[model samples]
Target: MPNVRPGEKPEIARLPLFREMQEEQRERIFSGSFLQVFPPQLTLFELGQHPDFLHVLIDGLVELYATSAGRDTTMRIVEPVTSFILAAVVTDMPYLMSARTLTSSRILLVPAALVREVVKQDCALMQATMRELALAYRDMVRALTDMKLRQSAERLGNLLLQQERRQGGNGAVQLKAEKRLLASLLGMTPENLSRAFAVLGQHGLEVDGAQVRFTDQAALEAFSRPDPVKDDD
Candidate 1:
């Protein structure tokens, strides 16, 4: 899709991040902001780049990633109806990670200066920001624990379980992302992901290209042995 400038704006204030903010503060923050469209694989920002805007994802998906020593890894995937990279915008520091579009996306870009000012003047917005940042931190810790504790195949199995739950427990998982990107998010090479899939196949997972179904979910649960602390959200 071609990138569209702010043409038809959505109800940005209705989103959770902006909902608690005062209308006056919301208007002030959004007055200078604009909605933008981005195509898949486009980089929104890179590590160490100073942030000028706080991006609110109105639709579609984004990938947060970091790289060093000539390699890159996916840190997290941001879904719709949420804001991302708030720390840099609030602290007036450079971004610690880069963001890229995983799908054609709609985003609202609020000026960094206005965001800071609104947060200072609006207590509700400040409380909301603090809550989001706290959740983000806990989420990072949970992800780290999952990476450190689980084996590659175990992780893949648990991920399938989580996906099933997320998609309404139909016993099928239609992957919304490319296997390569999923592999990166799993902290494994694509080849390793393939091998992991093959292992899960022996257990209960049925892989049909991007689609997966569980023939014996009980068996999968046995093999994965998901911990509530790590797997529960």
Candidate 2:
């Protein structure tokens, strides 16, 4: 069972899944949820652990990673105002990856039992959950397609471009995670990532420690060959 406490839950109201829920249903959800805080590098749960709560990251960063044998790879880094592990909660299954905070975070924990019960009773919630799941599936397919079709350098180039866009169109990017994690996320060894960065420099991509930049956006884009389906965050 998850830790439950009495408190405010205004953050839950902003979730798309709850937007269309009836007032009564929303109250039911509110009554069963609680908020918790965690520091950076704290592991929220390990892979294969059963879902106890549907975590909504109201603030800070969460990294979802998976381990195989002795090696672990970053699966995704989640930003604020999003719900994670919803599929696990709805299906009453184990988490496919482990989650840890990359920065101090405040999370809303809605009990799994309540979510399961409410989702079954609330048609709107059910529809929203299905739509979220479908979007996740499509994203996974797009990520896989990019991995299969692009070379290591191209993958890293596309990622830098995506980050630049995330930081606004200023042609500047500050990587949130370390190079090792970034390499794993891009499916490359650290050495390969270094080589890729060196390659991009010739095309106007600049790397200064953790910051990447490019004033000649056209040149960089020409090398990266940006594709929306693969590059959109």
Candidate 3:
């Protein structure tokens, strides 16, 4: 991993959270921050480890998971421009879940102590942190509701629809992550996911390897029954 040099200050300052902070506050945080690149499948932090840094994914994917009875359950996928394990960092507690890279990634690590100190001294920073925390909590609630109420097929259909929207509402959607990882994200076994896809095929959803096409969007939506309040993009 390479350290962030002084010349990269401007680029680092461009990050949403950092951009909202005062110059001095930003400096305080950046003084303790460094950038690192990791290869895919590298564990960035383990469960129960001390939250020494607030890690922000600059690019690439990160998986947050909890282990139980020797099996790992995926909790969330951290996309770029987002911070992970912030609640633990803010509380000065151990990380409740382990984080690992899903692809080669660039990350910014800001010392958690500096983050807490800056939040204490800066109202803007505190408000920003609160907003981020609130959004994350809301997302968790939605995910729980989805898992509780939706069947495996419905979940997969809704996910495809969301991906379609992300791809500018085109009828064709491509899977960015592997199907096995997608299965983990949806809280289903790979076999179950395959079955789910097969079931969805009856409702105008076509799956050919990583590519999915919707033959009848209306019919598929009717089958998926996506609720705006519950379905997060």
Candidate 4:
């Protein structure tokens, strides 16, 4: 059974899955779920553990990583209001990646069995989840393609452009992950990321700590020009 403190029900129900659910459904969910607060750097679940609960990140960020031998690679980052462990729970497999709190974070924990039951009965919930999964798949494809086809310099430049767009303009955009993690996400090593930053400066991308400024958008975009493919003809 999950540990439910007083006054947590309302907070838990405000999460996406419970927000749209009927009162009865919400009640059923709360009956089986609770909240957990993790301090910064805390490991929520280790790799290869069978995930018994679905985790909804309510605050701060969590990073997922995979390891072998003595080294590890960051697999993904989860932000607030997002959920994780869907694939593992749905497939009944141990988690392929371990999750750790990047900052102090609050997460709602619900039994995977209860969630499966709710998903089975609620068409809206099921459809919404499928949409989330689809977007995740698309992101994975884009990241893989970017890594395989683009030079490290181009990948770094493109990531700058993407962050600018995400921030609504190119003037100042902040990085959400640590430099090393961001390097991994962009499929570059830390030293390579530093070299790429110097290369970016050559192409007019200026870094100001966590914030990036595009001093010459045209030059940067020129350096990021797409390659022609047979399909384009």
TM-score of 1: 0.90
How many clashes does the backbone of model 1 have? 0
The TM-scores, one per candidate, come to: 0.90, 0.90, 0.92, 0.86
**Candidate 4: tens digits of C-alpha lDDT, residues 1-233:** 35766588877767655667777867777778877778999898989999899899998899988899988888888888878967786667899999999999988888888878888887766776676676667767767888888999898887677667657864566888889998887767999999988998988788889888888888988997533221111
Q: Name every residue pair that clashes in candidate 1.
A: none
* Winner on lDDT (1 vs 3): 3
Model 3 lDDT vs. the true structure? 0.87
- Cα lDDT tens digits for candidate 3, 1-233: 34567888888888767777889888877777889888999999999999988999999999999998999988888888889988999999999999999999999998899899899998878988998898889878867877999999998898788779877888989887788888998999999999999998999988888899999999999998876664334
In terms of lDDT, model 4 sits at 0.79
Backbone clashes under 3 angstroms, per model: 0, 0, 0, 0
lDDT, candidate 3, at 6:
85
What local lDDT score does residue 124 receive in model 4, on the 0 to 100 scale?
A: 64
List the lowest-lDDT window of 10 residues for candidate 1.
Answer: 1-10
lDDT of 3 at 223: 90
Which lDDT values do the candidates have, in the order given?
Answer: 0.86, 0.84, 0.87, 0.79
Clashes of 4: 0
Q: Which residue pairs overlap in candidate 4's backbone? A: none
Per lDDT, the best of the predicted structures is 3
Per-candidate RMSD, Å? 2.9, 2.5, 1.9, 4.2
lDDT of 2 by residue, 116-157 (tens): 999889999999989878877886776687699888888888
Ranking by TM-score: 3, 1, 2, 4
